[model samples]
Target: MEAFFYIVPSLMIAALLSGVWRLMRRSRRVARAWGGGRTAQARCLRSYTTTSGGGDTMVSTTLHHVYEFTTREGRAVRFEEANGPGTTLEGDLVTVHYAAGHPEEATATAPAPGRLLAESGCLLLFLGVAIAFCVLFMVTAHEMFAETDGLMP
Candidate 1:
């Protein structure tokens, strides 16, 4: 149906916007954490996996790691983060950056300048291509429908 076509494009736009919003929030979080936080060596306390969506389709599993570190004032803090497999294992030592007041909010890796630029460029290109295709498809469909008299039952 023509209504269905328009709805699909609207959904795609909404989804794209949602993705961009999430990316921006994460970028802000990472930037703030890395820029003003103190760095420390953290020990990998444990690792675990969580699964979702099984049966008759693909099963998705995500690896999460917990790390513990002590502050200069001698307080111990532990936090968990989801990361790819083999990135961190039990007993591994990794460098982390965390705010002085909130040691629980820490990041394991800092984004490299080149890598950040490339990632942003890739996201921009993807958005442009996806929007172009959606516009082209909608235009073509509208024109085709305009040339027709009406829907044949």
Candidate 2:
């Protein structure tokens, strides 16, 4: 049906917006934590490979690293980071940035500029297309209703 065109794009736009909102909130949380967090030395306890999407097509894999550190108050904390597995090895020393209030939420690596730029570009492109499709849908609906009104006795 003609309505499919409008419904599909509308759903996609909603999904994209939701994803962007979540990412923004998470980034803000991490940024706030990093700004007020303390620094500590952590050791990479182990590394593992996670695989997804295989079979006859292409397979994707990511390496995850688990690190542990002791807080100033002598509390032990462990965090897993999938961003920089190749950069560290078991027993390797890593610098960790963590908020004192939430030591479990820590990161050993900063977000990559290239990846950030790529994501921004993709989001912008999708937003532009979605807006255009929405306008088209509205115009088509209006025209259809106007024609029907004229046809009725």
Candidate 3:
């Protein structure tokens, strides 16, 4: 049981770390190559439209502003989830970086390595780590409890 606890946490942490590392590295390289350019940072001005006196009030509509990155090859690319009413606006000029090899590979300015790996935000990377920690804690507690009670349940 103890061995299982150690192995499970180690694997979970390894996977999470690998994913976070990859994203951080990719984002960093992009920033280093194209930190300053013709990037536009626009504020996300949103408007909700709905029908009056309608039972479908729960349904909502919004106009999202997206950022477009024009690579040197005349190709346009945008960051993932970096669009919509919740993200930066259309007219806002945001610092962006792109992959020289694949123009389509672009994103908002690369975050600091430390920030990318261990920062508090709504990013998927952070979420992955958080979930991994939760699982690890649960597994460890269960193993400890099972060992003490000598019961499988």
Candidate 4:
């Protein structure tokens, strides 16, 4: 029983490590693309929103924006990303970065290594860690109180 309770924090540690790995990978990818890519003028095609988790939990909404740009070789490329120019409407001009031959590998804006949603796993990790700590503390206190109950009587 107590062992089961300790598992929560152990799982949290794993999750935290996973999050750190994801964040590092994400940062590296962004840095690689932006650091070694060419810049082009992109146009906003359309933006859409998705909603989830309605019952028993707060509704979550995510907005996705799509952009179309032409590479140096005149190849047309369209990419969808969760992060892009905010409040930029359709047909608006935006900046994009992409490799010389790989137009599909592109990003609208250069996200800072520490700020990229970096979100990719940080948010989930934080939630997991918080829940795990709560569970651990609760289980520990319960055991302490339970053990002392007999002495009090």
* Per-model lDDT: 0.77, 0.76, 0.54, 0.73
Where does candidate 2 clash, by residue pair? none
RMSD of 1: 3.2
Error of 1 at 118 (Å): 1.3
Q: Taking the candidates one at a time, how many backbone clashes does each contain?
A: 0, 0, 11, 1
Per-residue lDDT tens digits for candidate 2, residues 36-121, read: 45888999999999988878879988999999999989999998877575968899998887788888878887645466557766
**Which candidate achieves the best lDDT against the true structure?**
1
**Best TM-score goes to which candidate?**
1
Q: On residues 95-127, what C-alpha lDDT tens digit does candidate 1 reach at each position?
A: 888777767777776646566657767886787
22-80, model 3: which lDDT tens digit per residue? 66675565554464443433222332333334485565454433456566666656544
Candidate 1 weakest ten by summed lDDT? 144-153
TM-score of each prediction: 0.74, 0.71, 0.39, 0.63
Better of 3 and 4 by TM-score: 4
Residue 59 alpha-carbon offset, candidate 3, angstroms: 20
- Which regions of candidate 1 deviate over 4 angstroms? 51-61, 70-77, 84-87, 99-104, 149-153
Ranking by TM-score: 1, 2, 4, 3
Arranged by lDDT with the best first, the candidates are 1, 2, 4, 3
**What does candidate 4's lDDT look like per residue over 76-152, in tens digits?**
89998874556878888888876665568688776465665556556656766676776778677567758977243
Backbone clashes, candidate 2: 0
Provide the clash count, candidate 1: 0
